[model samples]
Target: MNDEQLMRYSRQIMLSELDYDGQVRLTESHALIIGLGGLGSPAALYLAAAGVGTLTLADDDRVDLSNLQRQIAHGEADIDHYKAQSAAESIGAINHHCRTQVITERLQGEALQHAVEHADVVLDCTDRFESRDAINRACVAAGTPLVSGAAIRFSGQLAVFDVRDSAAPCYACLYGDSGDEDQLTCAESGVIAPLVGMIGSYQALEALKLLSGCGTSQKGLSTFDGLSGQWRHFGLGRDPHCPVCQWRR
Candidate 1:
């Protein structure tokens, strides 16, 4: 770390868990974030600001005027722009030292697998169940840790699936392969803006912990109800019949 880096991250480095060595680990790690919308926005910002060495942002959607309500990574000027590119610009503004790669398309198949393999940690910030399932499969295949989050209406969910751990459950184990075509989205059912920020920030926290090996993984599922202002956490069990991860057992 140079003099500038030392000063820039001095606060985090001061911690016992994230001393110089941990900070170095974070600086040498790569994070893959799929989605540059509500959940991906805060996750990418925090990861970049925290000095993740490399960030790969993948999102096929363009920034809509409605996104500025919760997608903190983009602004009015970025409306109509590709979300991946807009997010990269925001990240660059916060941390010039953090290298960013933008993939302005939805990733799947070999491309998704390659991205998962390269990343030290993957953040599944996408909204669709299909994308989440694909990401989970790729992470499980590559034995990479995944931080998944979702927000809709007044509720949000978060989970960490460390496929490197034999006991951990993959996303498929929790939600299964069945597609919920009628699932409510932020667009369909109005969302509270801060709900996404809360979940996305937690995703970033989990990624940092996984990357630096500084904290215990928050295994299982965590759900938040904005209306009730309460959080519920439950242990997750691997399903024996899970198609995506059954072979692991």
Candidate 2:
């Protein structure tokens, strides 16, 4: 890292837990963030601002006016623009040193697997169950770290899965292969704006932990109730019969 980078990350480097060495690890790491929606917005921006070496931003959808209510990375001008590209521009503006790779299409199959395999950490920020399922399978197959988050209505959820550990539980372990709550989306249920910011920020925190080794990533399942202003943490274990992860066991 250059003098500018040292000054750029001085505050984070001040921490004994994440001193200069940890900052270096962060700068040398790569993170793959799928989706550029509510969750992905803050996750990408925080990671970029924290000096993640490279970020792969993937999303196929274009920005819509309704998205402005929660998607913090996009503005009115970005409406109809591809989300990946818009988020990439925001990342660039926040930290020029942070490199970004924008994929304007949804990634799946071999492409998804390839992206997960090469990343130091993967952040699953998509809304659809199919997208989350595919990402979890890829991460499990590649033994990659995954930081998953979701928010709808007044509830939010977060979980970090280090698939490199055979004993660690994955997203599927928490939500099954085909999650029944497909219709439970912001569009359908209506979400408060800051709820996503809270979840997305936590996802970034977990991703940074995975990359910088500053702290242990979150384990198990964490649920947040915005209405009650309460958080619940529950232990999560692998399912012996989980179709996506059973073979690993």
Candidate 3:
């Protein structure tokens, strides 16, 4: 690390767990973040500010006026810009030394698999279940750790699914392949801004821990109900019959 780099991450490097080596690992790691809305915004910001070496942001949506309520990565000036591009600009402005890659196309099929395979950590900041499921499958297939988070209304959820641990549960095991919640979305229900910031920031924390090898990751489910300001943590185990991981075993 150069003099500027050292000074840039001085505070984090001061942590006993992150010291010099851990900071180096973080400076050499890459994180793939899906979605550029509520959760993705804060997640991207924190990752960049922390000096993540490379950040590949993927999103096909354009910034909308409504996003100003919680999508902190973009401002009114970015209103018609593609989210991935807008997020990259915001993150770049925060930390010019960090490399930022913007994928303006929506990730799906082979493209999603490629992205997850190359990333040290994958963050699912998306809202739709389908996208989350696809990203989960890719992560499981590549044995990459995933930091997943969601926020809607006054509720938010965060979790880490690390397939590196044989006993850890893949997302499909807990949520099932398909369910009744397909119709639910934050757009219709509305959301509290900080609810996303809280959960997304946690997602960034998990990603950094996974990347730097510096602390215990969530590796399970943690739910937050912001309306009452209550949080819950639960242990999760692999499902012997889960199609995603069953064949691997």
Candidate 4:
């Protein structure tokens, strides 16, 4: 919008699909990114770099030595530091234009709902099913668009669930919210470093599309198999019995 912003994002503005208008939209958006680990790392950085105006990063966990292998946002000096704090610092280093808000504690109940309500878009980078379920519910209630990404053991998946659309499927529709399913975490099962980076980048891309209105909102499940280097995508339907989104149907 100004001289500095125009020069900073000149290349992006050059794209006809996402020209000056799209860049302005991105600069006016606010995105909430939950988790600051594997998936959150890249998602946060790219969104900041892509000119998302404001970013709220929430994560209570402190950085561990094990995270450096894949959590690119934190450095060796950040070990034992709160992940959200560390990541906010990293984002500031790259884009002074990006206003970064750090939530150093786990967001729950009213706090979670407030965060989702304030955000123009939400990115579910958390690994736990419980956390994912909670985020999905809050987004559904607030009618906020959500970009969810997951990666474990050389595999990753991405999905966008916009509860604002009556026909769109929420995360709960794709994965039941019962929490009875066996959840394999990256810590327990192990994950390739690049796998999460790839998925997280896609999450950032989807968020930009939703905010800037540059591309069509993607509706479906995209799964990536790192072992075979194959990508499979298929449309996901809203489950009539889905506790989170069934009412909309």
lDDT of 1 by residue, 1-249 (tens): 999999999999999998999999999999999998999999999999999999999999999999999999999999999999999999999999999999987799999999999999999998888888899999999999999999999999999999888888999999998868888778888889999999999999999999998989897999999999999999999998898998995
Per-residue lDDT over 67-175 for candidate 3, one digit per residue giving the tens place of the 0 to 100 score: 9999999999999999999999998789997898889999999999999999999999998888988999999999999899988899889889999888888888888
Candidate 4 has its poorest 10 consecutive residues by lDDT at 174-183
Q: Model 3, stretches more than 4 Å misplaced? A: 181-183
lDDT per model, in order? 0.94, 0.93, 0.91, 0.94
Question: Which residue pairs collide in model 2, if any?
Answer: none
Assess candidate 2 and give its lDDT: 0.93
CA shift of 3, model 3, Å = 0.8
Candidate 3 lands at a TM-score of: 0.98
lDDT, model 3, position 158: 89
In order of appearance, the predictions have TM-scores of 0.98, 0.97, 0.98, 0.98
What is the lDDT, from 0 to 100, of the residue 221 in candidate 4? Answer: 96
lDDT tens readout by residue for model 2, 1-249? 899999999999999999999999999999999999999999999999999999999999999999999999999999999999999999988999989999987799999999999999999999889899999999999999999999999999999999888888888888888787645878888999999999999999999988888888777999999999999999998888888888885
For candidate 3, which ten residues in a row score worst on lDDT?
176-185
Report the alpha-carbon TM-score of model 4 versus the true structure.
Answer: 0.98
Report the lDDT tens digits of candidate 4 across residue range 1-249: 789889999999999999999999999999999999999999999999999999999999999999999999999999999999999999999999999999998998999999999999999999988999999999999999999999999999999998888989999998887874678998899999999999999999999999999888887999999999999999999899998877774
